[model samples]
Target: MKLRIKEVIKEQGLTVQEVATRIGKSKQSLHGIIEKGNPTIGTLSDIAKAINVPIYRLYEDDNDLSDSPVIICPNCQTQIPIETSIKIKSYNHD
Candidate 1:
């Protein structure tokens, strides 16, 4: 799953080095986090703080999905569609 961080970084118009400095990490370290693609929530929180955005923005939104309910993988940023089927069981007890 991907965090879509690269896109956010680009949108923010801030270079990786700039963010790394704000987050107290090195550019290499920040790149490693993106390369790993499996950052912890705390890590994400830190990034959000550095980028001055809500953590949720790091994930994909409705614009990224189609007819199905889709969730983005934090490590790979792939959209996974969820089944929207309902199952109901009717039982009679006398």
Candidate 2:
């Protein structure tokens, strides 16, 4: 699931360093969570607080499927099969 941290940060006009400082984490650590999608619960909670958004906003409902497929590594411009694209790591490896 996408964390939507970047979106919130942009919407709020908050720099990564600003949020990181507010949440008591290094800027690099917060960037890793946003780009790499592996933040601990505590980190996520802090992010939620920083953004003034609920934790659930970071997670998409499994039953709510979007019609469009999400493509990664668009260098190939390949239409990745959504049903088979199990994880972000798989997409990154493509």
Candidate 3:
């Protein structure tokens, strides 16, 4: 699923570096997440905390989360696209 990390960060007035530091990740690593759309659960959780947003918000589809203008990877310190490599699924065993 596409994540809205960049939009949430911007909405919270957070810089990529700040989010990276808060999440114990390098800017490059975080950038890779933005570009590659693959972040560890721990990283996503930390990002959720840093931005004061729910994890689901990051995966919301209505806001064009994947089409965000930029993303910073803490691993590689690069800015890249937010297209997601994995699809999100909702569990409803009813």
| Candidate 3 lDDT by residue in tens digits, 2-69 | 67788888888889999999888899989899778887766787899988876655664654534564
Residue 87, candidate 2: alpha-carbon lDDT: 50
Cα error, residue 61 of model 1, in Å, equals 3.4
Models 1 onward score TM values of 0.62, 0.58, 0.61
Q: How accurate locally is residue 62 in candidate 1, as Cα lDDT from 0 to 100?
A: 46
Model 3 lDDT at residue 88 = 91
Q: Rank the candidates by lDDT, best first.
A: 1, 3, 2
| Residue 38 local lDDT, model 1 | 74
lDDT by residue (1-94, candidate 2, tens digit) is: 5556777777778899999999988999888888898677767778879888655555443433245444332243233435655555434554
Better of 1 and 3 by TM-score: 1
Q: What is the lDDT of candidate 3?
A: 0.74
- Better by TM-score, candidate 2 or 1: 1
Candidate closer to the true structure by lDDT (higher is better), 1 or 3: 1
**How high is the CA lDDT of each candidate model?**
0.75, 0.67, 0.74
What is the Cα-based TM-score of model 2?
Answer: 0.58
Ranking by TM-score: 1, 3, 2
RMSD of 2: 14.6
